[model samples]
Target: MTDTRTDTRASAREILRTLVGRDDADFHEGQFEAISTLVDDRRRALVVQRTGWGKSAVYFVATLLLRRQGAGPTILVSPLLALMRDQVAAAARAGVRAVSINSSNAHEWAGVLEQLRRDEVDVLLVSPERLNNPSFRDEQLPALISRVGLLVVDEAHCISDWGHDFRPDYRRLRDLIATMPAGVPVLATTATANSRVVTDVAEQLAPAAAASASASAAGQPAGPGVVTIRGPLARASLRLGVLRLPDSRARLAWLLSHIDELPGSGIIYTLTVSAAEDTARLLREAGHAVRAYTGQTDTAEREESEGMLKRNEVKALVATSALGMGFDKPDLGFVLHLGAPSSPVAYYQQVGRAGRATENADVLLLPGIEDEAIWQYFATSSMPSEHKAEAVLGALGDAGGRPLSTPALEARVDLKRSPLELLLKVLDVDGAVRRVTGGWVSTGQPWVYDQVRYERIAAARLAEQQSMIDYERTTGCRMEFLQRALDDDTAVPCGRCDNCTAAWYPSDVAVAAASAAAASLDRVGVELEPRAQWPTGVASLGVDVRGNIPVGERLAAGRALARLTDLGWGGPLRDLFAVQAADAAASAAMTSACVRVLADWNWEERPAAVISMPSRRHPLLVASVARALSEAGRLPWLGSLDLVGGGPDGSSGGNSAYRLAAVWNRFEVGAELAAALAPFAGKPVLLVDDLADSRWTLTVAGRLLRRAGTSAVLPFTLALRS
Candidate 1:
């Protein structure tokens, strides 16, 4: 056994040398241990180390050694597309032939499967969602599971509900590990798991221990045990600090004034897509070469931006968390956050992108007052509610084995598109439903909603948010505080952070630059792209809508003064729209801003009249904006569209089809309004509203006016709900 371990270590060193292109390259302290356990002992192992610690090296080296012994290809389940791309490139440098099967390269899957069949690929990297895909799960996964020599779970923390970014799809990995042949080694790795998450993941990695006490009850035999290896969670090259600015303008001013002084090219992180886009625009106007990256960005453009940042062609990428995890740049010099994340684990994961290969890197956080609200939004969205789950099950059961598409399911449920999809994924994992070629069908299996478990998870998330709040206000060492939060035993004062030493970042902002930033943010006008296709399954609700909306019935692409989540006016808008706040007319500043927006709008034919959508909650606000626009634009004040009945109340929140059904035919053109609109028969009319959320109300109302003899309708709102 000793000789075998020694041989494994020697081969690992050779592979490491090839991987880094240097003869003297060696393994980190815990890398060899993990490799030896997997290659020689053929045992399961969990490795929890810091970001830059060589976790990939362990898997690649183990794959090379195991393949030399005539084992089948190693199957690696990765979490992110960027991570898979980087790993494929890293494997090539080590002389290992690797291929990836993910959503981006569906066209290449046939060739990849052929390579796998021929044993031409050494490593096969795939996303976690692919495991549940109907064709792959039924036709390919079983054979691959039997033939795979080793299994690797990267970013394994996501498997645990205790993790900050827990993913339901990753929980499917537990079953996959259980079915592997005995003695086929398994390895799980992550950099951000706390003690609870680490324990949870380790149990999942070794199913035998999890089943040992309940084997008889479960009617299955125990499998194998696991070994855990954890390392210190400190990044020696990072210099951490926090800059608490009073508002968005100050934060933007600080970036404009100090971006050049930062060490090298890095990322500027934002909490929302609008913030990223707005910040990137303002920075470019101030003469910085930067780009915005978010989930909304095209895949090709995202890849190009990643390459530009890697090559140091751009100073920074104003990005959301979309750029986190698996992006590699050895010389990245700085990372700045425009707002704090909800948990230290997530924050550490983002900041870890910098200073991986450099001697020093700057890490700074600019906490926002609205951070908690953002956190609450995400937290509530992520948790699956019992009511939604029950609604989905009922819908599936009613289908009677007929597969139902997501849109069809959305029409039947009260949840929105995204939350419904997430709940469906969770149900798929729990075996209550199945995804077939057409869509999803009920399994007719009895499943219980674990209310106790879900409540516990919600409580844990709230605790983490409080911990994050404490992290920002802590006067102690910041790095040490983060390390302790992750339950790292070796955490200590780094003597490098701002708290440990003196202030390392500039706090003063240039007055002129700040004024410019304020001006840019204050300038509000966002284009609202019109919905071209009517939602599917609307006919099921007795509505005649189906397929593409007729061009004559559609509203023109419209405009909003700002998004309710915008960095500039979002705070005031949120306050004004709060449930507890009293309904009032629009403020003078808001009215002025709306008038300026109208003044700058370049219409093909100027609007001949202005009309308001009748509102129940904010009637004064909507009426005030409509009157102001009518006065400023010198257009006729067409009376507001009259509500037919009670109209849908504030409780209406659901998918597109349902939302449309709620408001369809709910408004009728009164005699006075019809007469007022007749004069504008051959010209455009500006339709004003207090807010635009699903846009279903606007679409239905716009169709009514267009049919009532208006030539065109242009929708405008005080704010948009993204």
Candidate 2:
């Protein structure tokens, strides 16, 4: 008995109401407003969004909106070839005619180009390298762009040197974009761009338009059009650790153990091809299904390796920084820095590779004493400041001011080896040069995003570098320093780190001083809490089944240590420190105790001293106690920075268990902690921390005491309270 017309009208109104009520399910009002302005103006715009912001979604929506309005074919310039493939795939999934043209294409590209010319495609993806191609510019681009209504530049930061993966060709994109149809809107997007890059992008793409706009405009050419979509780095779910290692062997061991123990897919990033291969080999030898990828690897190898990891055929991967530039796998669980990268931007990019699928991810940095020297090798060797400008100019001459191969330019320039590359990179940042094929070439003109302003914006970046140096030398409140640096005024000491938990807590003697009238408890207040219970005022949680001694046999050290950590002891004692008794004639009591009692003690240091303690409970106790010590902030000098374990000499060896005490008391270590950790620091001293179960966590704590001029190794006993 209801009217059909009225019922239909009511249903339509209800659908409209549902959309309005679910506005929160979409973006905030402000985001929609900003997007609407960009789409409506039909003018090219730059969108500065932080990582995890729905940057791609914004553009996707914009693309669809523009298409609906009868805009021409949308051209998307992606920095990475892989990213182009990913986008095209996504477009295809969305039922759009999307095709990519890159170096990989031989026959398919011709068809794609034909489709573009015929206006049969809705989107065409190209790499920046292809945009610089003469044939592309002379024959393909003009025709292709003529049909383009919207031009999109993804990861826009690649155009600036301040960006981690700065590409010389990106600077030239502005010039080529200029040749496109007038009034064709260009939308540039990136996850990370400082103020300088923002200004540079504005001037380069929309120069005249930005120039005419009001100077007081927010995120404008006079300023930066950045929409602060988010505020502050999130640290709640993030547990940061730093470990110092002594040698590469220990580092490898540390990596083996940590990678074995870490759950989910992980990436171990190295600086060079050789290191990547070596790391993968070591891990594989340890029975881990690990794959290696680097710039030298053929594209097929890279793809296969990536596929294996994605499909869970391999548990871990060792790769150079270039391995996953455009990769979109979302299930990444952990990121390990086999070596420190050249810049903070590099650090963010590599680490950002993790936790992409709304999953938890952890990052580990393992540095060694030689780390600085290696980085100095990376920074100062061939690219010394004095020779940079000359080499760049020479390369320009070699190219006859035309694009040329990198090898050819190196032959033409007569300077140090690396400075030429650095200079080229620098010029590329300045928009004075572009990298094409094997050579350097002029883009025919300068762009608005100049290097000078970029350098200025990159100033804060040095503070992070300085923090690394300070970590090498500092001895106090390493956790406090790290928290302050990463979170600024809101930083608080993270109890998870060695320095905050172990070094800062008061000694037993100090507590007596504070409570002079109280009688000393006979039990020493040691209470045994099950790992599941997580006792208050105790940072370590380990279960001692069978009373810390299984059948009174000394051989059960490794199993006992694992049990302790599983119970929540949370440290590196699954092996290194354990139960064994030393011979009295061969070693001093402490040394002998470490040998006979411990599982792996070498006696090269003792001068006629002997006697060893039985180690049935030593290793597990040491690890458990160390965990407790670190969490209580009694040994604040150790475990501050985010790193792997330190070696015997207190350098990070790339292993997790090897990260001993974080550098706490000193201002700088005189040498690099590892081949990589040193280069980031301008000086030697810095504060640091450790990741859980990393070798450096155990060794550095002991080693740093020596560095601070203390000769004795501090020991902790774990006897349950009566």
**Model-by-model lDDT, in order?**
0.88, 0.49
Which residue pairs of candidate 1 clash?
none
The ten-residue window of minimal lDDT in model 1 covers 213-222
State how far residue 390 of model 1 sits from its true place (Å). Answer: 1.0
Candidate 2: regions farther than 4 A off: 1-25, 28-34, 180-182, 208-237, 380-464, 467-722
- TM-score of every candidate: 0.97, 0.56
lDDT: worst 10-residue window of model 2: 552-561
Over 4 Å off, model 1: 163-166, 208-224
| Cα lDDT over the full model 2 | 0.49
Q: Which candidate wins on TM-score? A: 1
